[model samples]
Target: MEAPGGPGAPPMWGPGRKMGFGAALGSRSKGWYTVADGNLSEVFFPFLDHVALHELRFFVSAAGAPPVDDSGDGQHSISWISPGVPAFRVETTHHEYRLTKDFFSDPEENAVLIAATFTPELPDLRLYMQASAHWEPGTDGNFGSVIDTHPPALLLQQQDIWICVVGPFSRANVGYFRSSDVHIDLTDADGHLTYTYDRAGPGNVSAGAEIGIRAGAFQLAIGFAHSRADAEEVARTALQKGAGAVRQAFERAWRAQPEIPPALGKVSGDDGMLARASFAFLHCLEDKSHAGAFIAAPAAPWGETNHDGNHVYHLVWPRDLCRIATALLDAGDSDAALRAFRHLQSQQRTDGGWHQNWTLDGTPHWQSTELDQIALPILLAWRLGVAGCLDHDPYPIMVRPAAQFIIREGPLTTLDRWEDAGGLSPSTLAACIAALIVAAEFAHDAGEHVAANHLRAVADYWNDRVEAWCSLPSGQYIRLGSDPDRRPTEGSTAPEFLELVRYGLRRPKDDRVLRSLQGVDTSLKVSLPAGPSWRRYAGDTYGEQSRLAGTDRRAGPALLFDGTSCGRAGANT
Candidate 1:
């Protein structure tokens, strides 16, 4: 039976389904678009953290066969059009026809342009464009309509957000989702648009139009604006400019980035290309309005069957920011790295703490606090200070408050980096200890001798207790701080113990560290044909289940529920 309308929830957020994303560099463009399954997936506007458009899908049908949804039912593959830019060429080979979509964002305005071409145009080949506009972060009450325009267009709105799609179409329809929409008609046995409407609103709705394919090709533009007129103009301008020209601008904009640093210029071939790609992707993740803010990802994890809107992945995390900042610093973009530090300063809580994660506007989400998150900023500041990148002192604004917070809540944390159980996690403790030492140095440089001495003492105390609190009787480090006598096997191993060496608290050759390494390898590591990989830990049940499994395993103590008898498939994350 056909489910009608469209997908009930947003598409998957993992890169597998979300694929690659592209946006114009700098602030000229305010929209970011993602490609997946040979079609446009989520389109974020104004901010990287907020998802405005659910998906813009293309469909094709012949005289007597069911219409093939380009993103829904065909075998599709994606490759980068430009080596380091987000521009992508997604090709889908269907049983009846082949389609190619070249995706890129407009560098001059807020729009997503796609140059679509279908080969072997079948007899009575009918092309359709479907727009599923969530408007906000999730799919809820939305209004869609067919606007009166030259080439015909569609407008969707939710609250203050408005999105308009413009292209060349002969016929169009808008209706409520599921019960009476174009999707229902497209999925019917005949694969035709039998039912149609002028507008649908105040509930889940969808809009579709019959695209006029000229020479087996069509161009599309999706634009964001505050009003319908503005959106129309945005989309019209991009379409008028043509996809090829806009794409050229997109490539030129990215290629115009600052010259590669010595660290990046040293490598060549695929490795060098991969490094440049990393920097380009990192650039795409940052918020346009907020200089230093970058979302963790442009997708929602487990979005396939998980329709719960509350569970999201596109948000800011201080822990993630630390890595991003450090990467930028290593890539020799000190300006970007410093901007990230300043952004952190603004997001820091009045008590010198940070929430688990947050939106770009510093709106906190998630309840737990990981000490490493509180400490990593100080570590980054120290790194920047050491590299002489600290144009203005961070001592009073950032370093002082963060160091004080760690002093008030060190060693013991409410949760680990995984947001699971909280205790004296060696990784968290390592960061805290390392942060305190650096904070003391910053304080000493700032001439606050008393504060500097106190921070150093705290660092010393935490460093001394590293082994006592984390080590088990076997000299292996336990995953968390607890009574070693009653510790279970599942609690005996974790990959986070390596932070001891990472933060310089212990030598790589240390006997205790070596023993913990072996324990982790024996318990959590999985040797695959490609290479050796490690799960979060043993007895962990926080991932997709295997196709062969019936139910998930019983979750560990820190986790809520493990499956009863299910096998698990390893995630590539």
Candidate 2:
């Protein structure tokens, strides 16, 4: 979903469903859902109440059933689900029962349309909704409801955004009752409402409203507003415009997305579906806010740690962001790339180091002294600027410090990308060498010829150091230069040689490069479903703890998906 205004605007759909953050619509601010106890979460106008889109459902009677029944028959089964158009489809093979529910939100600000198109049309269909506020203390807590007295039953979140649940308003059969209460009198009075936390409400009953949907199509539109009256007005307009118009409006709004950044237009058939889904999942992972960067996963941002007592991937990792940004650029979207660049720039340390991950506000967390984080950004920015993916300069503050830091840390002992507090590794030095060339070019473009020369000279020296110390007589490479203990021809060393060639640091036929690749293939390679996998390092005591010496321990012989020979997917990582 595009922002309320137009194209060139940020998309709103996010990883709401994947993360179970109650963010089904995945709006940067507006959409959220609940997965607790199989209950539909609340979607709140984020700017208004700490409300969520929580209460939403569809009730259909196949053949015959009450419009307000409490239970569902197996007859109402969904035959298909789609991420894009046609949204969700329900069909019954035994009879002529079929209906498709299309759920989508507005192009501007906030609004969600849960529309249904029926085949063999059921005139007694009901669009069930609760005018429930997730917030407590009612209006003071940025929550309120507009029920029976309005054009459509509506729920408001502090007047900021309102959920206008549209239904057949002319029907007087609707009344407000407790959501969970077994016995309660129905209130058809001027004012009636309910509140339920989509996450943790047991007896959380909601006073709801229902609209009788006519034959062809119907909708329950959740709209954003700043006041109760405005919400009521939006409900009025939506009722008048109807579900068909709302769907059409949204279609027009989202029409250009598949064309921009991705177009995925070139791929056809199942390949296209997979490609689109991949792009959509990545986009869903995005926070969609102007200041937000693409987070690593479904987890919410800003947390220092996850449930397992380790750092969460939900926050931005500079190295990870650089790679993600490059992919976006490759896919023809420089906006995400540029944003990733800016976000990483904001996290660079004064000493030219980066934290392992960072929150949205740029706060450092899980600090790791990895060299790539320092070097990768410099390379990414320079590449983007040169490739024309970057519209603005990212080097005025990035190149020099990165070059200096890599120079300072290249020959020193530092944590490897594997997070081990081991001494210097060749891959770290190799990556720095690549980044240095980019930085030198950036320096040259800025008229800093002397600094450029110094960077180039240092890069050459590091390249020489790597070749001199890490090379073994077996035509293979090692991780540390000074010691051979705990060394078994590291699988991680295999890529350094290839990288050296890619960045112009080494010749393709260079003996050391050939030796390393040949050695890794012969020593670290293992069979995998797709192809071969490599171990983190030779003598890699990955899963078991005791590698040096222990009677009760054994090294893991697992193959990881990250192209490593460790067991499972992330044994060494």
Candidate 3:
């Protein structure tokens, strides 16, 4: 696309590239941008220092205009809306900067260059600059500026690049500009400039520029920053001395990366429906990890606000942490998988349950109920086994106390219901019992018979209750102590039944239970290798699914029997 300017516009101000920033760097800086074949282009430039304050601008032709909307708070921003394509935009008021590339281009054969100029509208301050080749995210989850040795930082010289201080600006600021496999230089012709660059392997060379001067009209160049008669000569020297060898080395390193299949998973249909869904789930999984102890859905808490009108899902909850840890473990990030376990152990309540939700500071704000909290240790212990990380036999200490609390409080009795605050549901009691049973097994493995006995008693209480509440008409278990005056709705039973099935609790074989399970299976299935089937009974839908009536199907839902009941089919047997 053509750069934004009138016909025959004299090369606007700086550089010889007629395409301007629009062609080279794209108009916007936020989303994604490309230089080579669109497929080999994955570039991101996130400004750190002014991320929160400054606005990012992208100059796109009509063909590339992003979906525009006012960020509910009234700020103007464009949403890329399109999936997969690398789009660009800017962010204002950031503190640190970051760039990510997925080997879309060849560093040696192709060059990716970026340049920035600082012109102070007000003059009285000098821009202090520090730039590095690459920085990884800090332990605190923010990006850190640490120079890595494997990819060396590019050298900088001021002969060709003008590094003049236009004015003594009030604020001393730092800015960065980086390019891969390219020569970089800063000169003090019109103003001071700073440059950062890295090279992977030998091939084509590229250059980038970054300058921090009092916000004003300043001029900076890529190869030559100065306007001297010998500026080209100086620029060539800078390129040869500062960039050539580095570019060659970077090219070699870039090529060394094993070319495995792209991380993109399977796609279904012409529209790539499955691929889109997978991308969304994976993106959410990655971004959610950024929440520290929890995973926030990509839609955040905003899209699915809780009953309290707050964004509960925006913060990490116990359930999400468990799912995220499992996903991480599955993805081969064992270390990160363990972080959630440790976080859960650290947050355990004195009574052995975890709070429902917490803010980023780890402050518990919502209800500190039994169900949510109980799931924490249970999930942690389960993951320990799944991830092969529980060599120390930490399950008893991690899980027994919670189980004991449930046993002491009376199993199948609502200990605490966050949603109703005062009322208890049979399903809640069942879930608590199910968790305690798992905990009891862990206790038994640890030879903690006393804890095991207590858990066993809790399980007995729940089983007796389940037997009494079993409804032949529904073929599913009814919630104990549910008000007879209230009508049972699909929402009440589906989730509860699904949870019981998923967690390995025995359900009566009455037609109603069969019908209920079939109903759930039909509603939640997405296409997969085996067949369309119900999604797992996550807590959100557990309560509802549990109440449905059973139906006979020639083929039953895919049943994943927990170790305890892998062979058992009937409660009597």
The TM-score values for the models, in the order shown, are 0.89, 0.58, 0.44
Name model 1 segments beyond 4 Å from true: 1-16, 121-124, 135-140, 148-150, 265-271, 483-492, 527-530, 547-573
lDDT of 2 at 508: 86
Any idea what lDDT model 2 has? 0.50
Candidate 1 positional error at 64, Å: 2.7
> Scored by CA lDDT, what does every candidate get?
0.76, 0.50, 0.35
| Residue 556 lDDT, candidate 3, scale 0-100 | 16
Model 1 residue 106 CA deviation (Å) reads: 1.0
Ranking by TM-score: 1, 2, 3
* lDDT, candidate 3, at 520: 50
- Residue 26 error for model 3, in Å? 26
TM-score of candidate 3 on Cα atoms, chains taken together: 0.44
Q: Give one digit per residue, the lDDT tens place, for model 1 in 291-396.
A: 8887888887554434455567778899888899899888888988988888888888888888899888888778678999999999999899889998888888
Clashes of each: 7, 34, 95
Model 3 off-target regions past 4 Å? 1-292, 298-312, 370-372, 408-430, 467-493, 507-510, 517-573
